[model samples]
Target: MTSEAKETGSGLTAELKELCQAVSEDFAMLASLHNKEPDAELLRLLRDERFPEGLGLRLVEERGAQAVAFMQRALSALPDQMGQADLDELAADYADIYLNHGIQASPLESVWTDDENLVCQDSMFQVREWYQQHGLMSTDWRIIPDDHLVLQLQFLSHLFAAGKTMDDLREIARFMDEHLLRWLTSFAERVAGRCATPYFAGIALLTGAYSEELRELLVSILDEPRPSPEEIEDKMRPRRVEEPVEVKFMPGMGPVV
Candidate 1:
């Protein structure tokens, strides 16, 4: 290759790496926000001008722009000097949305995807299998199912940070298409509509938009077309046919045969 070509290739590699790092950090931040109630440290971080500026820059598309605007508005609603009362209110809102049994919005993939709207269902097991394929496992699956939003976001962060090749990006794209993208938009809309605090509502919108943008970014980087939602659904649907089982009965319950 020409020296100019080599320089271009190197520059592109550097740019891709920077992009992955930024995306990884963004996922980690979102995971942290959903993992627990906001504390003083988190509150301070949100209020920092750099936070919004950096996020706004990263989220430049139309959907992402809306998310950034909502988040900025929410942040602006916070007190300049946060007090215990402020923290308590935020905590309560968090609990109402994330911790309550009758939560307005659930943060589990199964809840949104399952027909019965239950947790710890087939989707959770499927997600667990995906983690195992990656040689990764959640620290406590009992407490938090494998398909929980926080864990999934953390997994994406891990994937982006560790991904270095086109194949790795492909895997990330596949995982997002198969899992997070399936229900994230619905979850985001629910949270945005029902959450008591504007912060979480903003976060919900941001997370949804960011995931969409990130998926598009991956498509651009990999130079591959993303499958439609219907295509993904058809691919994921079960195609297995079970064999008929011979009927056996207890002596007392047996019919004349």
Candidate 2:
């Protein structure tokens, strides 16, 4: 390749790396926010102009206009006449939705996946193994399950920020496809239905949409070059039909195939 072509390719790689890192940080921060009560400092951060514009605008472009509009409204609400009572109400909403017994929406992946709707099941252990494979061991494992929403998203942030190799990209694709993407959409939908505040509902929408967008982004990044003519013909050649077989289910694991 020409020097100019090489330089352009390198520049594009750098830009994509930076994009991944930025989105990773966004996910990490937002995930951390939902893990606890909203303090005054957290409220201040939300009201800050820098809080939403970058990721929010990008999400609008990728996801849709409606959720971003709701998100902006949530941020706008931050500066409104929120007295201590109002703040307490907001915090209460968070606790009721995320922390209460028999909550409408549990943030654990296994809860949404298992027939029993339990936590710390197979999916949780699977996610924990994936984390350890990537040099992450949960410091909160004594209290927090490895597959808590915050931990899962935090792990995704690390994956994206650290993803530069083809293997890294492939690992992320498998992890999301087999884990987070499997359950987060349902979890987000529940959050939208249950959350009293747009702050959290917007967060739900943002999390689901952003994960989807990143999955697509990684797919594009990992796209293979055109197949050889022989390979193309082999794929194009007609195959004999086979009888359908009975299938057993593996919850949250997609098709057994």
- Highest TM-score among the candidates is held by which one? 1
- Candidate 1, residues 1-257, lDDT tens digits: the string is 00111111122377787787888888888898888988877777777854556752287899988888888889888887889998888888888877784455788888877778889987899988878766788888888889999999988888777777777788889999999999999989988887778988888899999999989988887889999999988886556698876776677797432
Q: Candidate 1 versus the native: TM-score?
A: 0.86
Alpha carbon RMSD to native, model 2: 11.4
TM-score of each: 0.86, 0.77
Q: Which parts of model 1 have CA positions greater than 4 angstroms off? A: 1-12, 239-257
Worst 10 residues of 2 by lDDT: 1-10
Residue lDDT tens for model 2, 13-96: 676777767878877777887788777777776777645666721753446456667777887877555678878877888887
Candidate 2's TM-score reads: 0.77
* Candidate 1: count of backbone clashes, pairs at least 3 residues apart or interchain: 0
All-Cα superposition RMSD per candidate: 6.9, 11.4
